[model samples]
Target: MQATLTVSELLKRKNFEHCEVVAGKEGLERRIKWIHIVEVPKVEHLLKGEELILSTGVGWKENEEAFSSLLQQLITRNVAGLCIEIGSYTKSIPSSIINLANKHKFPLILFHQEVPFVEITQDVHTFMINAHYEILARLETYSRELQELLLATHDLSDLLSHFHQYLQETVVLRLKESTTHIFPPFQQNNSKQWSIIHKSIIDDTYTESKKISKKIQVLGKEYGELYVVVKNRRFTEENMLALDRTALAISQHFLRNLYIEEKKKRCENEWLREWIRGEVSLPNIFHKLGKIDGLHNYEGGGVFLCRKQEGVMWEGASFSYAKLLLTTLFEQCGFLLCITEYRQNILFVFVNKRQKQTWRDRFTQSLERFKKSEAYEKHAKLFSFISVGSFVDRLDEMEKSYKTAQITADICSEQVSSSETLFFHDDLHIYRILSLISDQRALHEVIFEYLNPILQYDKTYNGKLFDTLKTYLACSGSKKETAEHLFVVRQTLYHRLAKLEQLLGEDFMEPRKRMALEFMILAYEQIFIKKKEEKFPQCSEIEG
Candidate 1:
């Protein structure tokens, strides 16, 4: 069917004695596309390198400079190796030429046997053409498979399972595995694979394969790699080339599927979030989701809001597919959750905690598992953090909990931005203070009332003291920091604090009152901005 040609295979041909392979570096091989043969030196003008260029030396006279010119020209053209036919006229491959080839590390060949040059030309070209054909055929097949994958209505897991079956091959998606599951096959070989196959690939090219190592592409982007380890390790240059093309096709398919899945999730996420916004009752939320199988007997429950920073958290996972992914990640105790709101944000559905003795512990444990799952890490950066607020078990608690989730998630998102992320609500002291500002009306009242004296002071005297207090509170009440930030001396800052205490008839350093006042100021900073937006929606400066 198809011919296989390797560096070692090509060398085994008879009549090609004294044929030496030089410059077999990975750097050299990548630049080569295919080998070629032409009798005319004029062929050099039309040549692209990495080709095996041949000549009979019929037109050349016996000048040393002329011999070296052809050699130099071949090097400049970047031909992989040169095959020169030696005859009575040439009189045993020139010693000077031999020295030059050795010096340049150019592969030089001399044919002493009575072998037809046409035979070598025909065999090599025929093999390459066949390889091109086989590669193209496989690509066509994979292209069709990609089309089917996009058209299918199944979720990510089903699509992947079906894809593997269609190809009659195993496919693996290697995420950064946790201690729980073994890193599956096709994850990645150790670093040795990089050094071993590098010799065959020319550039940071799209895709290529040598033996089991295949670089797979998806929509011209290399998202993953594939390996097809068979019984034979005898992969040649041509063998690898064909497989490279195949890998490109398959990888393209996967990338396309991933894109489509993301788009579908976005549409579904919008619908789901809209559904969550309107959710008042536990069963009502599930009914709107059209996934209410487990909600019949389920009591009220808690809600968690998880947002991905920029893109979908689970690259290929969807809300509909959460059934399978969450099943593994969580205890499958939750049902009908959706990724709603901004980037890959997730909202959960669980049996509402009816018992006062057990308040949100199991739900929190399940959330802890979800945060540490393979899916979350895959798309962690898209959202700065996925936060769980106080779970609301009652209908009235849902509204406050929803707002608390938004606040806690914002704080959680900002905390573990780079190295590590936290899921459990461990820092209760800070979170509790922040949670106090979750009520919209109460938050609004605190902001306006605390700032009332300051706002009045600013309006009456154009005083910088009130603004300084506001800025300091906004910056989380750091003193040396506040004075430097406000362009005031530390003593001036103390004087202003004294004025504020006298004006309000309250102690500025009292632990209880200061904590309340500080939270009120923080609430003002948080919610006042929203009110300003609602007040001036069309103002470009205020909109963001």
Candidate 2:
């Protein structure tokens, strides 16, 4: 250990035999703060506490009673000791002064022989200053070691263990409700039980305790706290400062983890998007799946998608609320491997198959529970559609499943009703096929070709031909049923039919010809007409 002079040690120095302790023998081990030589009578102002005062008897020369009072003042001012030379102005030690020193246990040293106060001050002060510097140097060394740990260590637990080694005390890091202990490894055999108790202790610990504590706040965000539990003396300022530096190191570690996780999430999200778009081939997808830990282990699974209703205002608070609710709902299904992403108004959930028998039931129950939950109630007005793709056995088919789920979600979004919002791609195969046809411009033109002439004739003549033709086909060629449905007399319908026959051809209503016209009419209504009506101005139809 580094050396420093104490009161007892200073007394043992050579040429210090002239110095005899008159009182306060119990305080012999008090560390000497500094050596001061003062001849002034009133020296309280000139002395900082903990100093060893060296003086001649000039202050106590005239009155011995006044010297007794000086001893009390020195004790009150909390000095180390008063060392007086006896050969100077006053010869003998005063009895009253010695009695006062003994009463207060204040150290009063008597120098029988002439002593050089200046030389003693020089040696003692030099030693004291050097000791102070030693402490600072040790603290600096600790700080550098901790900084090196921050640079070299990748794991928080490792850094925490090092902090334990340095502090030589139980260090606990409380983050949110999680507690990390330093003395015992975090994964100790008894760690679980200890963690419960230790966490409670940390929570219940006195907030104002003298124990070292520093909140692990960095980059304007407060992560948690770093604190030491020492049963011995209160932490010195050096200890507290050490804890502060360690807290900063922990903060940097946390920030590094956050940045790495964010980058990983972005890369994973982009890869998933590419897979959903079917840009990744089967071979490449299988290769990627091999790299995933549990891809081949899944038994059965599908894609899950959810979104806020279109036109529902996307506010920050509501978006966060929706994201959290959806995440919680899917994450509770333990065996289902899932990765989620939120973009625009949609939350995409990609789930891997699981061997559990109740997986389907659990997923269904979770959905029902979410619907009735407070989270759902808070944003129910913004509820849109929930779509699940067809489950496939192999992992390679997940990309197709995601695409199917997305398509169903889009279709369900447009047809809002009081009906169930959940859609399954397996039940909508026909609609999926219709989606393909709906995307083709040429299909729109070919399907609507037969109706174009009739539409033009009605537009030019203000006739009800188009309406009559629709009702006629809907009635399955029953003229009376068509007239009844259109609220028109049979004679008027026949006249409209004659007009339609004249415009196109008499064979337009023949069996094979009628079948072709009927298919065209259905395709036009399902694909083209509905789209045009939505965009163009409405025209009068036959009254029904």
Candidate 3:
């Protein structure tokens, strides 16, 4: 609180009982900073603002116009009040001067009993100084209490509870766009009251309950708000400062705790990567996992490799969103795990505690619900390719499971007509083996060898022989159907087939050779075509 003495309070002091308010009764609440005694006609130089001017009518005995002008001057200077001692120099104040005081709401006091000015100033100044000291002492005690609380506990709820007790007022701490945590958590009966206050805070309005709120911000980010509800209570300037300091303490605590959480997440990410990479030995993997919170238990779970749909329009926020979404789903779906982002995919290593089928169904439902959620509506076209690895009880076998999951996800990405997004590693074992073989240069060479001559001929002659061969294979070696599909005459189709037989051997259409050609064409379309499109342009010629 700021130190001050109101006009009414000043008049209630000892030896000032004879003072009477002549005009401007409405200004009784006006605070008096100092007292001034002026007797001269020109009193501007002797007066300061918020001073109670004391005088004996000396220079203006019968000049009401000059008295009114003096009153107007005092009003302009923002003088607290005017106290005139009567019967010595002047008998009474004029009605015109009283009317001027009334109009301005300036306090006009009359000392009916001629008091000693020196004694009055001494008494009032001493009282004001003593009151100011008391306020400072109270402020110091309150501040020290808050500082001790800050040192005693890191829990924000406990700090807020103590603050409420100290102030004897309700204290609410709200993280912006988050739930409100109250000191004495709102009672069932107080729901309406809480709703009103919440609306007021969100709408940037005020309620009947006097409140002093400050934004809890640090490093240019506003974390939340700290507001004290001063219902039926008086809050002072000192209390406002106390609230500010307390909010600052909470902000620092949140920031410090946030750093620890980030460090923990980074460590978890690294450990999981190393586990999947087989860098950690079977015996040491569990020990390393013990270093991370909530992951110290025995190993028995499956791995999930999640990849977003190709060409999905999403920003970096999608990564965090996916992590948060999956983490929430895992926890609620009863398969607790840690999530890590590798490249563009998010991996989750679930700690197997229940039936695998049940967990799978739960995870699928959670993902479906997430896709339909408002939070994910902006990414409406976004879908995920999640592949689950086989359950393994041993830490050493986890890496093998993780590899299977990764391969399965890649196979799923290449699928064009799969109705389901979630794939099991066991169900796609053939494709997994095929994907491995598809990565070999020898296999690509064999596939490209059979198709390269036809490609070159088509490019050189601008002919449709490759299309004719593809269509003939697609029709399962029916020449009439191939001719009808190619919109060519039967004789022309026979002539093209003879030319093909001349280029390739007569045994090229054998079952084994045809099977190899079909496999080669599928490999060429899936592997080589995609690579050609993605490869950077070679510097074969200099640019102008």
Candidate 4:
């Protein structure tokens, strides 16, 4: 229904029978929301835009300049039109005023005979009031229908489709890091055009010429945008109001869904925490898995521990965002994950959903993709490392996986010079062996017995003989590779080697000695260096 009275429609009334359009006939479509009578010379401050003015020309009678100036002011004020009574305090219309009205398309109406100004105002005001009432009624109906649909279905796409049907216009919903839903879906050939338009909307560069957009916010955060395209006509204020109502409805839907999902996640996380800590019995674990769909079918699974770096404060929102990001990344690789925040680390239990033995390959691919994602790059500094445990076949064995992941994370914390942030328990060849030895004293003695002479020499002379020996042994006695790895000349490497041979025996390069030295080096790093730099001592235990 039309929301406002237009000049053309207003002229068709009985009160305007004596009125004649003298100029600006092309502006007959201008909207008129109110009617005002004015006999003043300056009406700029009296009228707002879209008000139809009724004047007797008494203020500018017999003065062409005054009439012209008054006409210019009315046009500048953006009034719908001007209706003037002739032959009363105004002899005739001015040619300059007529020309000005025509030039600016400012409607000028001449009343040949005097008509009751009160009657015209009453007629038009009544029509405007009824029009507004109809608009409110329509809006109420739409809102009620939307609320009913919201109750019937929780799908956002269904809501968009209903809005499309109501307006008979194209509707677009663009969500961040998720799919875009277009009702009455666009043609396949126009996908590229839609993408460009979506980008422009996201960049806030679009002119909004043919469409009206609103933001969909949940919990005071903007999640996406809603766009409604007006195909062939200008969008009225009523359309804007309707769009606002629709956005509110969508936001309410999102909030409802979030509340439901959060409640479910709380239950699942409680069970998962107990299961990880071995507090839940195996039978109860199986029973809980059976209760949750798509979880009982898992054939193999693992654990992931993500810890924030030292000095970075913990934020619940950041942890949630990270969990959401990882869930999205891994779910695409055929894995169902149960994530929870435990003690200073965010833990995830991933179960393979597919019936294939390629979980490892898929997990690796997912991790690599996640590292390259924009979410990771934006929040990369908030986390120190992500450690994954070895995959286990049974659901009851996840406790073992959590323990191993903790060990891997500890090893990751000690390697401060390593650029890699991702660690896997299966990949920790020597560190795994060291983690198995529970006696810290025995491990320290093994480290000292293997290379005490080189350690003492380096301590006395403040030399890098220890580092040089480690690098040399790592290079398998390849002098040229060792020199390059150490960023030193061969002469410097030879001098270090000579000093090393003097301190210990030349048998340091022997096969058995080389094995012992490599193992001892790993032991020293895991025991001494790791304990010194441990920031999350609470996370050191498996219960965490």
* Best-performing candidate as measured by TM-score: 4
Task: List, residue by residue over 197-316, the lDDT tens digit for candidate 2.
Answer: 465455665443334578886433567887776653445555676787788888888766755544454467667667666577766765665574335455656677766556666455
lDDT of 3 at 68: 78
For candidate 2, what is the total of clashing residue pairs? 1
Ranking by TM-score: 4, 3, 2, 1
Backbone atom clashes (below 3 Å) for every candidate: 14, 1, 0, 0
lDDT of each: 0.53, 0.68, 0.72, 0.79
Model 2 worst lDDT window (10 residues): 535-544
Instruction: Using lDDT as the measure, name the better of candidate 1 and candidate 3.
Output: 3
Cα displacement (Å) at residue 279, model 3: 12
Q: Least lDDT summed over 10 consecutive residues: which range in candidate 1?
A: 175-184
Give a tens-digit lDDT track for model 4, residues 212-287: 8999875335778898765446778778888899999998887677556655786677778878887887778767
Against the true structure, what is each candidate's TM-score?
Answer: 0.41, 0.42, 0.44, 0.55
| Cα lDDT tens digits for candidate 3, 46-145 | 6678888878877666678778778878888888898888877768878878888899899998888878988988887887788778877876786677
Most lDDT-accurate candidate: 4
Where is model 3 more than 4 Å wrong at Cα? 33-51, 57-80, 87-90, 182-186, 195-209, 231-235, 262-544
